[model samples]
Target chain A: MEGKVDTRYWRFCLWMGPTFVLVFFLCWGVLGHNFPPFPPDTPASEVAGWFRENHNGVKLGMVIAMTFAPAYGVWGYALAKILGQVIRDEHNIIVQLARLGAAWTTMAILIATSFWLTAAFRPDALPDWMIQLLYDMAWLLIDLAYAVTSVQLFALGIGFLADKREVPLIPKWLAWYGIWVGFMFAAECLMPYFMNGAFARNGILNFWIEFLIWMVWVPYLTICGFKAIGRIEQE
Target chain B: MREAVQADLASANSQSATDDTIPPGDSGVWVFIIADMCAFALFFVLFAAGRIAQPEVYEASRQQLDGAIGLANTLILLTSGAFMAQAVRAARKGNRAATLSGLGLALGVGLLFGITKAFEWSAKLNQGIGLTTNEFFTYYFVFTGIHFLHFVVGIGVLFALIARVRKFDLDTTQQRWIESGGAYWHMVDLLWIVLFAMLYLMRAA
Candidate 1:
């Protein structure tokens, strides 16, 4: 049993190792670069100057939407599992539907409200064209909701399946997988807010925290998932 | 050993065929769906930001669109989606005839949508409102054009499924695929509903 557990751990580390590597590179490559020293007064011209220095917001937006969002697809699956349980407990199909709707509505309202904090939202921080492009991508509020719902569903599905005496649905590794997956998703939603200094100065720490988490978590969960698949096939 | 292995493989394949074998929904498919949705969402975001940048231009362009046609298309698509949903249920019951008929109805409605969209595009084109005319017109054509592309693909899939009706054994795997495909088509239809409201009804807003 101990050997099996360690094997799963090793497998998880192997799978998530790349995600950690990417996160490390991103942190080092992006945050490590010498930013033209912070301006004391962010003049409109100075801001424009700073923006001109960077690739457009459109590029940045593309990076966020394409690279970042899809990377968290598994997390979305996990979150869907969790949310599905909450929905199931409600017992009314309409209420369950409404709850899903409410969760989506809440996420949208929050994200939109975040945008209103333009000082931090910094549409100009990225390139202008990219920002406009990202702006277009941002309308995918339902997609975001789906991502969140998916994670919720996965979490709940595992638990629900485990309860059935018949299929040994929740593999031993999955519980560990769940914690990490949950962390990644929570990070996805919270990182945006924190990245823009919504919480505190030097919120760059959030990035570092996420990087550290991914380094350990991504490979671990991936391995666990693959193993789970193998076990099911073997059975 | 080789013969034994071949026999084992055949058994596994046949078991997969005959049994309740819904491909797990937790796969790459949802990722693709979300990514596609994001692409469309990006377009919507573009619309919102453009409106922010040039509300007057967008408002004027929207004003030029016919609300009545837009509403009619919305109802047609919605009805089509309902038919597709019914087809999914019928397919589950192994009602091949009902599935084919339902799929045909859905396809017909989808084609009608394409025709109406073509007419709408042409009307705009005739009125000097090509993509190059203005930013609003640019988005108008782009959004509707992309949606029409999805509709075309959906119709193609429905047609392909109709043809496959003869071979499709009523089984879990097939059901899951059809259900998801139908769900996706319905989503496309539902999205048009919102687009119609935003484009036509709220023109004055």
Candidate 2:
């Protein structure tokens, strides 16, 4: 029989779930206020009104904490810890650190490339301030994913090659799958910028293709991360 | 062996085929972040369309936001993110006291951030600006409000982690908890930095 699931993890989930529901409800509730509340209608005037009317409230803090804490905070840390354990024997801790460093370095380069490319053709399409904002947000996503994935993959690859050990933290197939999926994402990110006019010249494929890929890959990565996290003890 | 590998790959492929609930990469703790981003995307899209429709109101409203508080919050969140990161590293090294201390520092910084935000929101509300006032307040309410909720949850998670971390195996659970927590905290911080520009600084320009 399966043992009892970890309650602390459940508590983390419980705390996270309701707050998520509330955010969605608040967003979709068809509530009033002219700041162009719906997606298609949003504009600078509406957003400015949003800025002008902005007030500090308990709800804001509550939402921020609920949305951010477990997802990136708890889950990300857990992912790191799993990495530390998975490679406990074959490689020293320094190797893990090196993997993390390399991952982040690569991510930074990719982000810089995306920013420079996006800004090159447009000139002032995105203002200096806006450019910086997008740059930071985009990089955060890149770095976080890169750091976590790098360590995990390094561990799996090394373990696979070294002792033929069953990579306890992540299933061998799942780990390989993650690397493949990650590589696809990298290719997708690089393709439009590198391939030039030959493919996706219309730019129509850029948006929809990404949508399709995310539709397939996002869940796969999430499941893999969670399964790996949950298996930490077993490892 | 080949057949087993093929079967595993098949299962993985089939698993990602569905488009219902949350996406696969957004399970467990990340469920909230994914949902939060979607909600924010909706808000952003709304903002974009609204700007297209009524450039005047959006621009005027932009002139009124407090850039100072936005900057302050950015700094606070960034600082808390640093603490959280430190906590994760400390925990991974099996330094229980350091883990607790680091988490405590993060929690304290987070609370300070909430307090400042609360004061900021209350002051704005007192000034007669709120969600019901216009589209701007609506987003102000929705976006900042959502961000605030995330802040609170981050604190709670820190507390929970602090409480139970002592008992768990340092190698497996403790460090991951801290790392994920820090990453989420950093996202919040990062979002605020964006908001600072879009809502506040962008207006000045």
TM-score of candidate 1 relative to the true fold: 0.46
Error of 2 at A174 (Å): 16
Candidate with maximal TM-score: 1
List, for all models, the DockQ compared with the true complex: 0.01, 0.02
Model 1: per-residue Cα lDDT over B56-122, one tens digit each? 8888888898988898899889889988987876776667788888889998887888888888888
Query: Candidate 2, A114: how far from true, in Å?
Result: 53
Worst 10 residues of 2 chain A by lDDT: A28-37
Q: Candidate 2's residue-wise lDDT over A1-235, tens digit each?
A: 2443332463343233234334423421212121112122235344333323431222243234333323323333333344444554325663454345434533443443343234333433444445334333433343234444444444433432222344444454444433333333332232222222111211222233323433343344345546655664453
Q: Please give each candidate's TM-score.
A: 0.46, 0.43
Best by lDDT: 1
- In model 1, what is the error at residue A59, expressed in angstroms? 20
Evaluated on the second chain alone, the candidates' TM-scores are 0.83, 0.80
lDDT of 1 by residue, A96-166 (tens): 44335325434553453223222224544655444333332332332234345434434433443333324
Give the runs in model 1 whose Cα sits over 4 Å from its true position. Answer: A1-235, B1-53
